[model samples]
Target: MIVAHWPPISATLCPKFSGHVNKPLKGLRSFTFNSSFSFKASFRCYCIKNENPNKISSEEGFSVLGSDIPWDSGSIWSTMAFYFFSLHIPFSFGGLSVVAQILHQPVIDPQTEALSILTLQTLELIGALLLLNYTAKPGYRFSVFRDVIINLGMSKRPQDRHAVGWSSPTAVNNPILKEILLSSNVSEIACILVYCIVTPLLEETVYRGFLLTSLASTMKWQQAVIITSAIFSAAHFSGENSLQLFIIGCVLGCSYCWTGSLSSSIVIHSLYNALTLTITLLS
Candidate 1:
């Protein structure tokens, strides 16, 4: 016959063993003591620091990819609207006028036309810079241009190579482009400065620095890059070279994302335009 034992009320209230108390029942010993031990062990395990210092915690990883803005902030939408109205619409009108004049003119005055376009671009650039100063966070004034060049080399895949070869413009094939490229003296110098420096700086500031950063506050970085690139390409208003411009926009967007610096994108864009202009002149 089994003997029945009832634990004292004190034993039930405080399961911890004391030298003065009798040993607990065999069933209660394993259930109460082992459970407490297991819980203590688990708590200790969690308290210990991770062995790998390089490994990011789950929370940190999520924070890195997540939006930087508060849910209540409407700055993103306001900035987007400002960019569309202040920059995109005005530039689209100017670009359309240029295209129309180029098509209609029997004999183009490359110098006069280039100077007029440069004047318009300068005004637009000034407006964009002012808007950026007001709406966006302060941007880095300097970046490692060589690092961006290295990244461009490292990131190039077969598809990118194909796109570059396929979309590269030839002055011989496009008469209007050829006329612009073959300009002489002051006109050529002005065109070069506009393409290589002014245009790249303005475009990178507006699209990558302002628009992309604003969008990233509300969406994933990848989505921001895609949307910014699409808008940038569309803003160029180049019918034949639209695909080429889009591909270039994607490249610039990715560079901006990786470097987190508008200067890097500006450098890459300036270099690209200079190289293409060189090729056009040589051919």
Candidate 2:
């Protein structure tokens, strides 16, 4: 207590203590501020670089095969009209000619009927291919068709014979059809090929692939399927069997819509025709 250098303890000591306490807090504040700024900058960069994962790409929206027809284009109607006339007019004329030729014959044999069926089916198949190639770019692929067939096989149900009118004796009693079924020669083989393969392929490609797709461009899918089915049934010109044909057509249309492949409907139709032919042969 000798008053040894009691030189202003309040000023010097208080200033030194306050400086020591303030230094670490200032460094901590600077570090926190720099870290926050850097975090904000990186966050902005990440936001700028990333895309929304939920967005649908254009390719995905329009990648449905057989649906590549330019529905919105003005030329679509003209193209449809061309397809209709080119396909049906030639087929109708050729079919009538064949019927006329057959009727004119002194004898309408099974071989003759088979030949006529083969000719008609061949013409139809050719016309279908032409129309498909002309109207739709990147036309139906075999892979797509195969997928459709597989799907049809997986989804098929056993149909009721009576309900579908197949139980009616008259259904399989057509003289021409009976002759083809009864024959065991090459004519019968040809008949089977036409009914089970060529006919189904042509009809399904036209009605389901081309017509249904065209109709769907303007109408609801349900309406398109119904209208196309109705037209398909009407094209057969079946009398009392028209109702059965209509039901079959509806089934085919639904199959096409479900699978988005003409081949599916074709396979179902072929199997149905094959079953009918088999039953007729047995009976």
Q: Tell me, by TM-score, which candidate is best.
A: 2
User: Which pairs of residues clash in candidate 2, taking residues 3 or more apart in a chain or in different chains?
Assistant: none
TM of each candidate vs. truth: 0.58, 0.59
Worst 10 residues of 1 by lDDT: 155-164
Clashing pairs in 1: none
Local error of candidate 1 at 145, Å? 22
Per-residue lDDT tens digits of candidate 2, residues 13-37? 2343443221121222222222222
Off by over 4 Å in 1: 1-78, 95-108, 136-173
Error of 1 at 137 (Å): 8.2
Model 2 compared with the native: what TM-score? 0.59
Q: Per-residue lDDT of 1-283 in model 1, one digit per residue for the tens? A: 2333344323222233322333444554223222222221111112344499788765335323235522224665676578667765564244435544666853336665556556656666666555544554434212323332323211110000111121223122444444655776777776676677677776776677656766776777777778888887666545666677778888888777766666677778878877766766766
Instruction: Estimate candidate 2's alpha-carbon lDDT, on a 0 to 1 scale.
Output: 0.56
